[model samples]
Target: MRIDKLHTIDSTNSYLKRISKEEDAQEDIVVWALEQTAGRGQMGTTWSAESGKNLTFSVFRKVKRITISEQFYALMAASLAVKDVLSKLLIKNVRVKWPNDILTDNDKICGILIESVIKRGKLDAMILGVGLNVNQTEWKDTPRATSIKSRTGIHFELEEILSMLLKQFHHYVDLLLKGQFETIKNDYEQHLFKKDKPATFIASDGTQFVGIIKGVSETGKLILLQEDEVVNEYDLKEIQLLY
Candidate 1:
């Protein structure tokens, strides 16, 4: 694993993509940035993190023999990797929110964004970007954001955590490559946030409803048991889970 340390960058994911195109990039190359000026999250939201305070990095991994339908396994691998790292640090209440936001208790501590490159209906490679709130202690405008130090009141070395993450990430990705779909899915659901709990959800059309989160479908859809004894699976664009 080669880590390219950067003082500042617009986005680590973008940089990795560029380097993978320009340079002869190899697999497992990590690009770590001290600051991200234009970081992004799911749903076109901005990922705001203080410079030199958080783990904002991306990893480029070359995939083989994986299809687009199997892409959700990559997400499961990444989420489980982060959860494993947090649990090893003794961070209690670590749960993986649907689609890939990591929450401890009620506040978000990490976010993952994975980009895949497909060719001829087959998966080529993926850029896995992670934004983890590590030592940052204060939350100014973001009320739901929290960090490891904020949760545990103890500072952590960013590189150490990154190393741990990479190890766990490789472990899960290897499992994915070996076609262990059921194992990964079951492990991910075990750490799923609010699983089997009744919660409110707002659809994309601004309609709110209550449903119990059963788990996720094989293709990464949120499987919700509705009030009228109907179970429906929704994509990311179809619904937003409300705490």
Candidate 2:
């Protein structure tokens, strides 16, 4: 794995996406920074991290073999990688929220964003950006977020955590590239947060409803069990989960 260390960047994802176009860019490379001025999160929101306090990085994964339709498995691979790492640290009650937000004790500890490049109807490389709240002692703007140090009272070395995560990432993504769908999906849901539980949600049109989560479609749609024997599938941004 190649590491491109930077003192600061606008966004690691953006940086990698730009650099991946270069003829010299290597696969399995990591772009890490001490701080991100324009770190991106899901839903077009900005991720804010204090300089030199947490892990803000993006990994480059060269996807192969699987059709464009099977892209969601790549997402599962990225999510499970982080979940497996946190669990090994003895983090209590670790759960992967739908898509891939990692939660410990029901508070968000990490977020994942996967950006892919496709050409001529074939999939290419993917930039997997991971933002983890590591040693930060406090989270002011995002009160619902927590850190490893905040939870366990012990600080961590970021490089060591990154190495361990990459090993697991290689394992799951290898299965994905081989088109092993069931194995990845089963493990992902088993560690999924709020699986089979009734929860509240808000629709994009400002409609509020209640439903039970029935895992996700192979395409990454959230399957909700509604009233009167109704089942509906929603893509990202169509629905928002309410805590």
Candidate 3:
């Protein structure tokens, strides 16, 4: 339950991992920054956040019994945690965009990046990085972005949001520890964006296709049903959901 608050940082995940290499970093320790000069996102994208206007932090959790193959479940738990808190906050149409982004009403409000440390051919620990827009009013030219303040018309206390977010994290983590994989996956799919609906996608080869999101595999690949009854499973970067 210890949080290391920094006024500014290059990246919370990098800081925690660097310190873990230097010292024995405690499990459940959170590295949060009021501002990040270089925040990270999924697919190696740079996360942009206004100073003191969003939740930019990373949480360290030591893996116990979770197998290496089910590692994506850890990410699923974390994404659901963010969705749960946003749902309780009255954020309408909150959805867990596949792989890791949090979207509401087709606008992304949060992004996550989970980095794991492997040791002895097994998963050791994971650093869950989260960036959520809180009070930022404008996103420059990022039209797909939105914030809590923009959506709710109310400013929020970042620490309070962090506390509630952690609570949800623990709640979902407990379920994960108890081996409720199907339950977690089902809950995640229930909040999935565009689940079972016709959607357009961009493939890595610069090809566009239409498909239905059939849900995700146990290993976290996107299950897509395309034309002529073709079922395709895609890992990250294989396909991108287009608005």
lDDT of each: 0.91, 0.87, 0.92
Winner on lDDT (1 vs 3) = 3
Clashing residue pairs in candidate 3 are none
TM-score of structure candidate 3: 0.98
Per-residue lDDT of model 3, residues 79-190, tens digit only: 9999989988899999989989999998999999999878788988888999999999898867799999999999999999999999999998899899999999999899
Specify the highest-lDDT model's number.
3
- Per-residue lDDT tens digits for candidate 2, residues 3-112, read 99899999999999888887545457899999999999988988988888889999887775766888888888889889888888878898888886999977999999
Question: What TM-score does structure 1 among the candidates reach?
Answer: 0.97
lDDT of 1 by residue, 112-178 (tens): 9999876577888899999999999887889888999988888999999999999999898889878
The local lDDT score (0 to 100) that residue 112 gets in candidate 3 is 92
Q: Between prediction 2 and prediction 3, which has the larger lDDT?
A: 3
Runs in model 3 deviating more than 4 A are none
- The alpha-carbon lDDT assigned to residue 83 of candidate 3 equals 94
In model 2, where is the ten-residue run with the lowest total lDDT?
19-28
